[model samples]
Target: MPSKFGFIYHEDFLKYNFGKGHPLNSIRIQMHKELLELNSFFNNPNIKLISTKPCSDEDLLTVHTRDYIEFIRKLSETGVGSVDDKDTPAFKNMFEIAKTAVGGTITAVDEVMNGSILHAWNPGGGFHHAKQDSGGGFCIFNDIAIAIKRLIKKYNLQRILYLDIDAHHGNGVQEIFYDDSRVFKISLHESGETLYPHSGFEDETGIGDGEGYNINIPLPIGTFDEAYIHIIYQILPLIAEFYNPQFIVLAAGADAHFLDPLSHLQLTSTTYIRIAELVHGLSHKYCGGKCVLLGAGGYSLNATPRIWSLIVSKIAEVELKDEIPVEWRSKYNEYFNENNAPIRVVDDNPPKIDPERYKKISKYVDEITNRVKENIFMLYGFFKLIK
Candidate 1:
């Protein structure tokens, strides 16, 4: 199965783990690699496993402030405070851990940009909530933004599109490029009405020259797969036809799976794979086959690795012929309460799609999609008025 896809990985990434019992912990990364190896997936000769050097201070300065970088460096060495009001907590060595994660993403970006790979993936990246000088939501620096800056600077990329499918709104990423027209952001998440970070409203389009470049679809809790596929089909193609970016970054978060403990969204593993395929196809169609993928949130003990496995297999286009690996399951049995861990290739049954919730979300999706269409027309009329 030797192929052209590139994967970003390094052993140092696991050292950045939060202390034991944190929701975002080190076990997730270890298990993902273990499953790939146990199943003979990464053994394919076509896929290249790589370790990238840490991004330099100049790289960090592109999207992060100098004072913030210095503060983080000192704090990483010795700090015992919280980085956010909730979620991201400060601890010793926070700087090195966060920096390594940012560097992993940069390495992925550089691989794709330099013609070494067509697509690159870094499961340790996607720290979307950190602002230029501040940390929040368990994120210390904005990896996606740093990568975007690198692309723009080195390649002179004119337009970049960021699509976040995480359960939480990407308020930090959205605010980072709020006034930069070269970036177009679209986020589909559990509406702030019920989720954390509580931003991403319909009217919060881009400002100034970036006006209308940012798009947000805040969904209600409990929405399921079919509704997700239908609405995304509509909007994604429209985005492909409209913004036409040079490349797209997918903030593909698996926590939206129904089994995840973090949020109330009810999507299944299949949905994650389908979205990955769509993003890959759209990138090829519009962005010259260049795509950068990042893993975000997923917390269900049994579901996290399975959902990610499905996504990786689909995006990487590898076929699986059998059942779950015994060694991998045995290791996590105690941690997962034994009975609740994934024991088969896929879940025994599809997640409950909740008809009532699906209907409500369809209504919301239809209304919003139509309004976006209508607003495009209204803008045209305004241009005529000025003339």
Candidate 2:
């Protein structure tokens, strides 16, 4: 009998840190782990707390180029210079730390597939922005891609669904599997026009055998929970049903929250729960709950932990008190020095978007959703052309 859920963690995950004042802080991961512990979420018999180890160069070679792997190794030795140009700053032992992060996800996939656990979440994984030969968006290794490749190789599974909701598009993963039909990739992000790595346009659907397997939904600025959830609820289930994936990999980035400094989307905690619920349902419905989730991107020290906690609670079917634990709050204050630590597990209300602004956003979302239906959904025979 498999446990209901597994949460992967490692103290070395904190070493994946970039530097002071960097947006991709590792402390949030620690805060989330401590929060769950303080809340007694781990005491449940159905939940398992799993330790992680580092992946080898051979494992990384499954998705990255050999020359690029050597480059990261040499850069890690120097402990100076960035991985690409600016975003990914290299540090001593960075290659080793990144390999550990990738290993966390791989272990999660193995655990789920081998029936040790029904589902798993690797807080250190989800480096979707890392390309084959270079890094970007603070991502050093494309762990999501590597894990997917490992799934196909080890389990002989086809029809894997890679869903990314990081405020930024998953350009690196899309680029790697752009022409491959075995993977169906969907990214819902803040429009690339106003964000970094300016791509993920609606028309960037896949080509050749991969045509229509790639889906991108670029939301305009000021997108609130109503519009955000509406798009997800409308599109995700239909695609999952049609794809009937044998495994699911989710890049559940918390940066889409309204409190996050990195993106313009205004999602509250409710939307995160809704997403977890939908994904949990889809996994059981399509893949025997063989799913691995990765914490891809989220910058808000205050909101990110709570958002992740909520998602984890939902997945484990564990109920939590709304109040933040006093001991955890003390630790948070000491680490972050911010007075505005979240007081509750969930946000009280969704932010209000200006009516006119929301109207424009709704129109744009409809257009994008309709375009996806016509382009991607039609390819799966989920939509029909009307004359």
Candidate 3:
């Protein structure tokens, strides 16, 4: 019997590390693996562990230019240069690791389309900020875009939905597919006014035939779980129902959590689980449960691993205790020299947002949501009942 869930991972994934102090550390990936291992998730008969091979040059060219690819290759060989202005640096073998990440995502898509699994997750993928000519935000290759292109060409997929919940905008993915009507991109993130890459405004609906196919909901800073959930529940289902995509790709970033160092959203582990549940439910309803989840930008070491663990558990339909495994906690404590590692999977208490502040944020989110609905939803005939 085939497994219901497939997880793509390789030890080589740890080679994508940016250095000791960089926010995009690969240690978080290892920690997530440890958490799942503590729970014996790999031993489950319904879950399959998959390995990844580096994608070929042809695969890279699907979304990147040959000149840019050569630049990255030379930088990787030298092992000492910044790939972009600053955020992404060229470490030893950077090109190979980034290529492997792309391959992992493509492999996940193949598994889903071939009926090997109903769903898949790649913890080392989701380099969504990289563009055709350059890398940014610690991303060397836009794996999500390359995988989408491969899916369209290999399987002749007509309608594919790319949903991003990263705290920062998925500008690269949106840009790559901006003029393609067959792929719809929806991103919910902190307003660009306060985040990096500084794009994904509500007005960036699309271009030419792709107009209205691109949807962005820019939430205000300090937005809490309740408000976030409200916006998600209101917008996602309607879009999924209207688009009726053949497949769903989710960029699940943990940076929006209150404990994260990078962004100003107040989401908790519970919020992560809820978001995953919503995406999982939507995939089942509209795409026959053919969804691929990718890890994106989450900086806080303690919070990121736990948040991702919740997402994996949700997809695998496994229940883990609230308490973290004692042995794992001790090991991480020894490794990080932090005695305060969380012993429980879920946050003990929800991060509190002032009622008045939450109201203000909620109103702002409503305005953006309404603007998106009026601008894009109407074009798709989804506005009839929304208004």
Backbone clashes under 3 angstroms, per model: 3, 0, 0
TM-score of each: 0.93, 0.96, 0.96
lDDT at position 132, candidate 1 = 88
Tens digits of lDDT, candidate 2, 87-144: 7888899999999999999899989888889989999999988998989798999989
279: Cα error in model 3, Å: 1.1
Candidate achieving higher TM-score, 1 or 2? 2
Pairs that collide in candidate 1 are 2-46, 3-46, 76-95
- Write model 1 residue lDDT over 1-387, tens digit each, in one string: 323567778777676666777888757777887887787777786677888666778888998899988888876776676776577767787787777788989988888888788778888888888898888877888989999888888889988889899888888889989988788888888888898888998888889977777788888888788777876777777767766788889888877878778888888876787787898788888987788888777777677777777777777777754477878878888768635667775666767656776678888878887886666445445666899
Higher TM-score: candidate 1 or 3?
3
Error of 1 at 98 (Å): 0.9
> Where does candidate 3 stray beyond 4 Å?
1-3, 334-338, 382-387
Q: Once superposed on the true structure, which residue ranges of model 2 sit more than 4 Å away at CA?
A: 1-3, 334-338, 382-387
Model 3 over residues 140-178: C-alpha lDDT tens digits?
999999999988999999999998999999999999999
Give the Å error, residue 45, model 1.
Answer: 2.7
Report model 3's TM-score to 2 decimal places: 0.96
